[model samples]
Target: MANAQLKEEIIAYSKRIGIDKIGFAAADPFVSFKNRLLEQQQLGFESGFEKGSIEERTNPSTLLPEAKTIISIALAYPSKLKNAPKSKKGDRRGIFCRASWGEDYHHILRRKLQALEEFILTKVEDAKCLSMVDTGELSDRAVAERAGIGWSGKNCAIITPEFGSYVYLGEMITTISIPPDTPIEDQCGTCNKCVEACPTGALVQGGQLDSNKCIAFLTQTKDMLGERYRKKIGNRLYGCDTCQVVCPENKGKDFHHHPEMEPDPDIVKPQLIPLLTISNKEFKRKFGRISGSWRGKKPIQRNAIIALAHYKEKEALPTLFHLLESDPRPVIRGTAAWAIGEFTEKSCEEKLIQAKNREKDPNVLYEIDKALKNKEFDKIQG
Candidate 1:
């Protein structure tokens, strides 16, 4: 069988299996990507959630020995939520980014990749194949860019002409050699909306990101969020979409091709207050299927507190106070203290003072003192 004929068959098969876009590329070491990773490391900009070493990340051969071709696939997701719930004054809602809207994309993409692998094995019985989604060592964007599936956007996302940047990427490396696709030319030309719109200046420059300052990364962390980023995070319980939302290429691009990728409005945009006391089992039952819940309930709970603060939802003060005094996790307790500070109610001060007296953790104590000082500052300003 000719490699070109196999490539065509793979593309046809991919479409039947729900893959929106498919491209092939030679499996060579991603040299430029490795250099960028080294620079990110030296600058302390990595998000710390990345798996594997830099060498393994940029070299496809390291993941699959004798890798000759890499096949990249893209599946577009819906940008706008249909019949979305409203966030009223007393009932504020937190959002998970569009990437986390439907089922966990990792599972969806892996399922498709596995089917492709099985199909490839049927064509060439001796063929070797390895597939990965977001968690894979190989960079999906790098592979996608090289494979001509999309141009790497200035926001550091693979932006396809059909789907814009609202696409989930996955790839598979195989021993079979296929004619590679031409790389897309960079189309971001002169636009800097994504960089300018970044709340914390996380998009340090076009095509480069400082993940430490990224709200998307910050929301996933288990520790107390930095004070400066709390308000910037707004109502996002998990992930951030400002960069993608503001991209010119992504304008008016929304797809509902796959039923599994359709978002449930209530799940992606749940009320902020109830999340404060949600049990682990309840959290799993509600959010376990989405990618945003990967970091667990603590980060989401903490972000929910910050969202309540961002809205200045006085109705949440009682819940915040309870968490401040009684939540076992320091991140939760500390974040609750910070949320309480946003309120000008007289009881907020009293609650902080009471928590300060009983709080044994230095981090929690520091947050309590900061809230107390902020309350004092508000009084002075008034």
Candidate 2:
């Protein structure tokens, strides 16, 4: 009964500290989750981005030996960007996903968890606590699910009743046992909207995801995007929101609870051409605060070139030609070759041929050859 009172105090204090939602969970091993993860690994569905081994991921005891409860918190982010900029003809712009819109959630959630840890220390002097954000071994989604923060939507997002699936989740494991909240009932029902709406079909069979096919994951890749996914990636610069955006539960669900979570229209939807030429210092100065810049500028630049091709911006041809001839990175040179080939320019074939002759790297040469083929096909169609 004393633990129950502590739970109430924690929940109340959490709200006072700007935590949008909080829930308690018993520090038990996620037995079924471990098996499911193993299955995902066996079926090659795992994204290389996961942080820990299966055992460490599913076992809370490994984090804190005397762990008795896990406290999960969620902070909602806005789905709709207010006064979003237009992506017009000569000034086409690429997009960073909604999750990357604001100041990085990792920092925000970490600070909140730290505050909660300090509060808990005051209540129970002997309590041992460990907290982590997305980078931590424990799965944020799994912890949120068990703690009843929200149901796991078909898109693999934790869908809270008040906030939809746009919430950032964090957790703290503690030796002090708190009463666990009942898990929210799965409400996805028979609707497969997210699966059907996914452009790359990354959401395989509802909640399970094949991250390789996920455009969100592909956008963060430093290597050239797979040829098959290039056209489908569209104008996405950082991540894909097709699954979440199409969720019926998320319809008309927009929140601006945290000021820091708000997006700057021009930054998130910046003109694509300037992105290709941004200096490292300039990129840091402008995008340094957002979550999208974590992977550095190379991938974003590559995707921007692909976005230009997707838009078929004829005005960008001159700049693309410059990148094809001079970019130091092979991925950039190769992607530029691919985008140039995608264009209907008559000189594209000749330019690709010249690049192929000068390019010593086999991969870049292959890209050039592929572009030349595209040029021939484009000419035939014309």
Candidate 3:
């Protein structure tokens, strides 16, 4: 099959197989993309990519030695969450951003790409192909832009007309050449809503997102966080959607509803007390597929403590006290102490003093002292 005929058939196959948009580009060296990837590494903003991304992206031959074309595809997962709230209620946990609410896109999109690859191989007889969703060294946003699916928004997410920025992207690297699609123009001119809406200021300027300050990243980190960032995390137990929710482009748009994306009854609006008390066995059983469960129960448990402190949920006092004495992580203990201070009253002051006496960790001691002081201040006020 000639290259021109192959390219046309590939696009047709993509649309027929549930892909919303498809674009083709020669697998040239990603010079510009490499520079940005390196810059992210230098700035320490990259999560898991910095360690080896430079070598893989700088040499196109690394991802696929004989790669001649890159086909980028987009699939929209519209937010059709029934009974989705207008505003967060007390001690509530919101669902993952629309993109991740369903069965993992990696599984769904990979199957589609594999079928596409098989179709192409049957036609060309000797075509070689490789498919990547979010797990590859190739720059997905950069490829999608070049393939003309959508342009990067100020929030650093690809924005599509059909689904706004709530879409998943996947790519196929092939040895066959295809007609390149014209790249899309940047339409986010002077729009600052995404930046303005971010609760943590993750969006700096001109599509640069500092993942360090990103709520989504902070909530999911396996390491312990200080009381400072914990307070800002609010009630979000997993990934955040502040920027996407506030984008003007997403206004008046309806999300594609999927049954799998529906919020679990307990997770949708979790009670802090119940969350703080969940056993590890229960944690994995309930949240294994949810975004926050990937780090196990520690982060989510810690976030529950933080939310209890933020909301001053007095009902959670016994649970927080148990954690203060028995929780394994010092960070969790400290947040538990903070919650004790914020939620407990004169009735709990003696326990706080007792906790301070037995606590070994300095951070936990500091939190106990803070809680004691606040308890004293509350008595004076009353």
- Predictions: Cα RMSD each: 1.2, 1.3, 2.7
Once model 2 is optimally superposed onto the true structure by TM-score, how far is the C-alpha of residue 19 displaced, in angstroms?
A: 0.9
What is the TM-score of each predicted model, taking all chains together?
0.98, 0.98, 0.89
Best by lDDT: 1
Ranking by TM-score: 1, 2, 3
Q: Residue 246: error of model 1 in Å?
A: 1.0
lDDT by residue (tens digit), candidate 3, 85-156 = 543434445345555565667777788799899999889878888888876777788788878888888999
- Model 1: runs farther than 4 Å from truth? 375-382
**Under the 3 Å rule for N, CA and C atoms, how many clashes does model 2 have?**
0
Candidate 1, 73-114: lDDT as tens digits: 999999999999999998899999999999999999999999
Clashing pairs in 1: none
**Candidate 2 worst ten-residue window by lDDT:** 373-382
Candidate 2 collision pairs: none
Cα error, residue 61 of model 1, in Å, equals 1.2
